[model samples]
Target: MRLNPLGDFIDDDTFALLQQHRLFDAKSVRDFQIRKTYREMRKKMTASDALDKLQELHPYLQYDTIRKIVYMSKAS
Candidate 1:
């Protein structure tokens, strides 16, 4: 599969850069970054703070989606 296929709902720049690489697909890259970012944010901020920061950085990101991912991961 193409790592940075056209349907991953990521920023264009990120997709373009990933498309340039040959090793990882978009899913791998996105999952890796999400975990990394979530871990770091947890170390320094409450979930509310992290959500605020993410909104500031990416206004399009829905907090609901992030909240679901966090809780679902914990449940698993």
Candidate 2:
């Protein structure tokens, strides 16, 4: 069985909101926002540049998380 990476972190309210929006439960809204940022950054910049820009925009997120999202989007 596949396990949701965000399962441990998602709260009841978040899950309800996701259900209402027909969004996948695997990622939270914040996670989706970060991924969206990564995707936008990947469009005009190198992965490193994208990661740097995303980190600058969201200093609270860890570097590795931004890097992973940027790289994964590249792979797709």
Candidate 3:
């Protein structure tokens, strides 16, 4: 479980295993990428601006929904 440059949590072998077992979690991977992108954006702009930019990238999600996803605990 090292994080790759692309923010993937599992190594290729583990990813392959998970895929083979049909246990790969697409939603969790998407959330992780969203959080990673948000953190990187925060370093260059205000939180509000970052959220707005993220919202632009994901028009299906509301601002508050992105806010919750950005701030949500890892255990969730």
lDDT of candidate 2 over 1-76, digit per residue (tens)? 2133345678767767876798874444456666766778778998788788888987987899777654564443
lDDT of each: 0.62, 0.68, 0.80
Give the better candidate number (1 or 3) by lDDT. Answer: 3
* 1-76: candidate 3 lDDT, tens digit per residue: 4434333555777776676797857676767778988999989999999999999998998899899989998774
Q: Taking the tens digit of each residue's C-alpha lDDT, what string does model 1 give over 1-76?
A: 4444444477767767766785456554554455556778989999888767765654665778665544555443
- Model 3: residues >4 Å from true position, as ranges? 1-8
Worst-scoring 10-residue span by lDDT in model 1: 67-76
| Candidate that would win on lDDT | 3
Q: lDDT, candidate 3, residue 53?
A: 97
Give me the candidate number with maximum TM-score: 3
Q: Provide the global lDDT of candidate 1 against the true structure.
A: 0.62
User: Against the correct fold, how does model 2 do in TM-score?
Assistant: 0.51
Off by over 4 Å in 1: 1-28, 74-76
lDDT of 2 at 39: 73
After aligning candidate 1 to the native by TM-score, how far in Å is the CA of 50 from where it should be? 1.1
